[model samples]
Target: MKTEQLINALVADIGPRRSFLRSFVYATASGVAFDAVVFFAAIGPRPDIAAAAETWRFLFKFVVTLALAVPATTLAYRLAAPAMWRRCRFEVLMVPLCLLLAATAFELDLVPPSLWMVRLVGSNSVNCMTLIPVLALAPLTCFLILLRSGASCDPGLTGAVAGLAAGAIAATFYALNCFDDSPLFVITWYPIAMSTTAAGGYYGGRRFLTW
Candidate 1:
């Protein structure tokens, strides 16, 4: 076909449905993954909440979560590897932003981190930094699912995805850490994280759409 005809066809094919679906999926996955991961990380080990005097179950579970989260996230990344790899600039900025946010949040007492992990250094900034590295799991999961389904990023929808992804991931992590104890963390940090994710996702989406 001619160039103008081809352009019109392409526009009609992917115009809004793709964008809407992409946003919807990304948001849904963010929420779902966050909830599941948090549940497993915080409550998987503790059967009898009342009987256990020590909250050491979290210690065990935290290690398990990290071990599990890393591989899980890695696999997800690999699945979405093409899109992720394509956004090298996002990845580059993402690392430092993750570090800054995590540290700032913890130094501000955003969430109580793994006990041993927190106490070992005693810097009060360690938890955030440590935690931030793994925060991308939700986004990667969402991204992977999108890529696998052959859905492309929607222009003007990325912020929403990023926000939902970030929020969902934060909620999951906070829920785990706060399981039965950290309500303050849940109430405070979950929203903060989600908002951050939304903002980032939207901005990132804007960038992705442009290229």
Candidate 2:
């Protein structure tokens, strides 16, 4: 109850909080690094990545993916804490949603109607859907395991968010090798891939995170 005792107690509480956060960071980094190694070793970046980088559409992929990753990761981390979970602003997700929508519209307007379906389908639709989730597996596993240490009110939702974050992170790397840069392709297939991961997360969370 004394001032010194109260300060010491607060510091003690902060120590574990900081440690948990650090662990989350380390888990994420390690998961991503593992994914990167697998990606480069097996599927490496597109040979023409330098030329691809010159295009706005190609660069925008990173923008949209990173946008999604940042907010989803933050929400997942916040959800790990019982008190902070309620305060997390889900609206941050709108940034990536808006960006994808605007780009899709522009792509639709710029291309011919006949080409719309082609762009949406892309050459790698199947691969896009398959690989993103595959790449996300490591990160999603790491996130779900990390979440176990926290007290989340809605385990399924927290897991879903972690899956979304993992998917986004995977997509960012996948973009480097993806030849399809059209927003139409991105809008259509990327969600399917990421949603697959999110679905997995939901199931995992419900199965594991529950007290």
Candidate 3:
């Protein structure tokens, strides 16, 4: 079969059920990576995740970061799959749900758009705004890739795992874009970015999770 045909078929298989899962995973994983930009940036190169646990403020944000996932996921679930909400999986819900959190975080002034840009050298953040593009770009691409590849994971676990991976990718890109090279910058500004990604994930989840 032609690759294009294969992808179209895969999209069909993903159907409504898998579509929601894929979006959720991609968005959520991006959240963690975005959160880490500041986490590691504040600590600078070679941050000891264990040793860096002393500061109460940073720690609070860390907890809040994960904690925010729940409400964010819930919000996405409400918006996307309110009727058949139980059909939504955590991992699948992770992407858009976290994306929503990122959006909210940005609006709330939680994190930078991504890596800080000294002179706007091609950078971006994860948030509601980003979700718009994801809606346009990610699904079709992801669906096609999954289709051509002819690989599938359990929507529940696969989506969650994928989300964490995607979140990390987002974080890496974010750090690169903002690369301010300052402990203060990470500590002070990183959370905002994290929040933005979280919001995007959440909002996406809200709309996508509408099973």
Q: What is the TM-score of each candidate against the true structure?
A: 0.35, 0.97, 0.30
The digit string of per-residue lDDT tens for model 2 on 40-152 reads 99999999999999999999999999999989998999998887866799999889989999999999899999999999888998889899999999999999999999988
Ranking by lDDT: 2, 1, 3
- What value of lDDT does candidate 1 attain over all alpha carbons? 0.43
Please report the candidate that would top TM-score against the real structure. Answer: 2
lDDT digits (tens) for residues 1-211 of candidate 3 = 9999999998886596566667555654444444455445643322343544454433443343344345444333333333444554555435434543554455346437564343122222333134322322332234223322222222332333323333334433333333232333333344444444444433443333323
Best candidate, lDDT-wise?
2
Q: State the C-alpha lDDT per candidate.
A: 0.43, 0.93, 0.39
Q: What C-alpha RMSD separates each model from the true structure?
A: 12.2, 1.0, 13.5
Q: Candidate 1 vs. truth: CA RMSD?
A: 12.2
Q: Can you tell me which runs of candidate 1 are displaced by over 4 Å? A: 1-133, 144-157, 179-183
Write the residue-wise lDDT of candidate 1 on 1-211 in tens digits. Answer: 9999999998997665567455645555675567567556743433444454355433332333233333333323322323443532334324423443454455447445555344333332233333432464455345533533433345334334444544444434543433333222322333454455556555655555333
- Candidate 3 steric clashes: 58
Clashing pairs in 2: none
